[model samples]
Target chain A: MFDFDATMPLMAVQFLLLTAILNAVFYKPLTKALDERDAYIRNNQATAKESLAKAESLVKEYEAQIAAARKESQSIVEKAQAEAREITAQKTAEAQKQVQTQKEQAAQEIQQQKETALATLEQQVDSLSRQILEKILGPELVK
Target chain B: MEILGSLTILNTFTLAELEVGEHFLWKIGNYTVHGQVFIVSWIVIGVLLIASLAATRNIQTVPGEIQNFMEYALEFIRDLTKNQLGEKEYRPWVPFVGTLFLFIFVSNWGGALIPWKLIQLPSGELAAPTNDINTTVALALLTSLAYFYAGFKKKGLGYFKKYIEPTPILLPIAILEDFTKPLSLSFRLFGNILADELVVAVLVLLVPLFVPLPVMALGLFTSAIQALVFATLAGAYIHEALEGHGEE
Candidate 1:
């Protein structure tokens, strides 16, 4: 049953030929396709992860910008309210000053008129007393 | 009457010989070749080639049925190569290992399924190519060459240092292991396949009924296992050959 002939070399050549052919047709192309698929999947996953990260960062940046804008708006509203309050206080102070000045001026004018009337009455009283004294002396001399 | 008639038929040298070694030898310019082995092998190779060409023709990322099977087979062989031959240099060995696996697997199953006896030759009949000692030996020899080549290529002159390792006392044994490796590899496949076929054949001859079905099923199972074993061992041998020895 153990026979060695040219069959060994022949079979070897046949196997070698088959191996080469199979590598060309089967193993080579099949593995290439499989590997390409694997690489494609890996690349896709990487791209998805990158895009997700990019989106998250963009969202964070947008939120930060919104917060900054909101703060700026709040600051602007506070400045406007403070300016309105200062203007109202200044106007009230000016009005109070004008009322005080008018009261003083009116008091001064009334005092001046009262002073003039008193002076005129004193002068008339002196004149009347002198006339009465002259009449009494004249009557004593005739007796 | 049936027993006598069976005996007469058996003696008349007709219908599945008990001694199944006879070959329909072909002489080509003073060279002889086994025709049955050639025919069956040609058929197996043709099937593999056609399937491979068709499935690989378009080369899509998403697989069809044939592509799926082919890809799975390639993935399996790749894993086998990477695991056994280690990660660094297993890529090149995948084709050889895959070829061996596919050929042997196809042959064993083909032998079991095909009614090769129907294709009557002048003397012998068609069967699995792996059933021949020549084919198995050829496969074993290829595996042997692969390991040795891997060793020489990786380590250069340092490949001989392994035979004397753990002290020179084990030199003979290590060398003997090399010879026995191929011997066992070839014989194991040849014997198992031959035995399975013979058992199924004998069962079919005796009972000629449902009894042979289980044996045939077992044959198919073992055929697959044998192919796996052969490929795995070949890969492992190459791995061992390629292993690094840090210094002298």
Candidate 2:
């Protein structure tokens, strides 16, 4: 079995041929498919990450807007409430002032009417007393 | 007389007979070729081709069964080549290393799995191509040529500078190493495969029943390991050739 012959070179050539054939048929296409799939997965992952970041930013922006709007609404409500309280206070003070003037005027008018009635009663009492005296005492003696 | 009579009976009865060193010769032009080796080598080639074709037929991103298996094999080869040849230079060498691994692996397994004895040959019986010294020598020689080519291509004439590295006295030893590399590579493979076949054959001959099964199983295991060892060593040789010897 120690024989050496042309089979060595021929087998080498056969193996080389196999290598070439396998390179063309097996290695090239399979590696290309593998590379393409790798690139596809990487591309999808990158885009997914980008979209997630975008969604997160949008969420933050909306939250900020919501917070600002809430603050603005609260301020507006407070301002309206303060304006209502101020207006109520002003209206109450003005009504009280008007009532005070009207009360003073009525009291003054009643006092003046009472003084006139007392003066008239006093004049009537004097006239009645004078007439009673003229009737009781004789008119010939008084003349 | 009794022993002689038993020997004759054993010879005539074909009780686990082992044949060795026989070849079916085929003449082509002026050179004689081993027809049995070619026959089995062609079968190995055909199997590889059909499997490759089936794997690449559809070429889907989501691979089917055959495609997945082929891809896994390719990835395995890629990793092996990359580990030996490094990341940068490994890509171009993948096909060569991959072919070596696939061819040897399938040939070995095929030899063990196929019932070659059933088909009677005119001269020698069919067996694994690697079991023949000629085939292993051819493969080892190819590895030698590949590494030399890789060295020459990468570093040009400077590849010869490795012979005299550290000291000029090492030149003869380095040159001797070149010859020994192929010798060892070829003999290791040839001896392992031949011994495995012989052990199984002898076991079967001695005990013609269930005793050879475990040895045959071990033979299969060794066959696969041999294929891997051959490919890994070949890749390592190429890598060594490509690497600069601290002179860079």
Number of backbone collisions per candidate, in order? Answer: 0, 0
Worst 10 residues of 1 chain B by lDDT: B10-19
Docking class of 1: medium
lDDT of 2 at A3: 89
**Model 1 native-contact share:** 0.74
Best by TM-score: 2
Which residues of candidate 1, in runs, are more than 4 Å off?
A: A83-143, B1-19, B244-248
Candidate 1 lDDT over B1-248, as tens digits, reads 24534653665334443446778898878888887788889899898899899889888889999899888888898898888877788999998988899999999999889987667788766888888998899999999999999999987998999888667898899899899999999999999999998787677667666888998899999999999999999998988888833432
Question: Model 1, residue B14: what's the lDDT?
Answer: 41
How much TM-score does chain B earn in each model? 0.92, 0.94
- Evaluated on CA atoms against the true complex, candidate 1 attains a DockQ of 0.51
lDDT of 1 by residue, A27-96 (tens): 8888888888889999999999999999999999999999999999999999999999999999999998
Q: Could you report the DockQ of all the candidates, in the order they appear? A: 0.51, 0.74
RMSD of each: 5.9, 3.4
